[model samples]
Target: MRLDKFLKVSRIIKRRTLAKEVADQGRILINGDQAKASSNVKIGDTLTIRFGQKLVTARVNDLKETTKKEDASELYEIIKEERIEDSHLL
Candidate 1:
């Protein structure tokens, strides 16, 4: 699955366009390397996303074309989530 599509299908970003934009801005990483919107996402791959002040890391668990809202989280397992302190941006 494409990174942008996976993000939306998994309900991580809420929209495909937003996910694409975020990925294009170099705010997403796959396996510790920068990822593009068209990057391939496979099961067991690690993904790190930068959302404003928060950094979220998750491991892809499954891939689905579509999923129910209640089961969206089944797509990935959250490994860590941390906030970026102001000093880190300096």
Candidate 2:
């Protein structure tokens, strides 16, 4: 599935458009490489997302075209969350 769609479907981001915007700005990485909104996301792939001063890392667990809100968390497993100083964002 698409990165943006996966983010939305998994509830990692509430909106697909916002996810795309974030991905486009180079704030997201897949397997340690910068990824775009249209990037393909497969099972077991690792995603590192930047949200302001925080960075969240998750491992893709499954893929679905659509999922119930309650089941969204099944799509990915959060592996780590860390806060970074502003300068590290560079």
* Model 1, span 1-90: residue lDDT tens: 999999999999999999999999899999998899999999999999988899999999999999999999999999999899762441
Candidate 1: clashing pairs of residues: none
TM agreement with the true structure for every prediction? 0.93, 0.96
What RMSD does each model have against the real structure? 1.9, 1.0
Backbone collision tally, model 1:
0
Q: lDDT values of the candidates? A: 0.94, 0.96
Give per-residue lDDT, candidate 2, residue 48.
96
Candidate 1 runs further than 4 Å off? 86-90
The Cα RMSD of model 2 versus the native structure comes to 1.0
Candidate 2 is scored at a TM of 0.96
Q: Candidate 2 — worst ten consecutive residues by lDDT sum?
A: 81-90
- Regions of model 2 farther than 4 Å from truth: none
Model 1 compared with the native: what TM-score? 0.93
**Top TM-score prediction, candidate number:** 2
Q: Where does candidate 1 have its weakest 10-residue lDDT segment?
A: 81-90
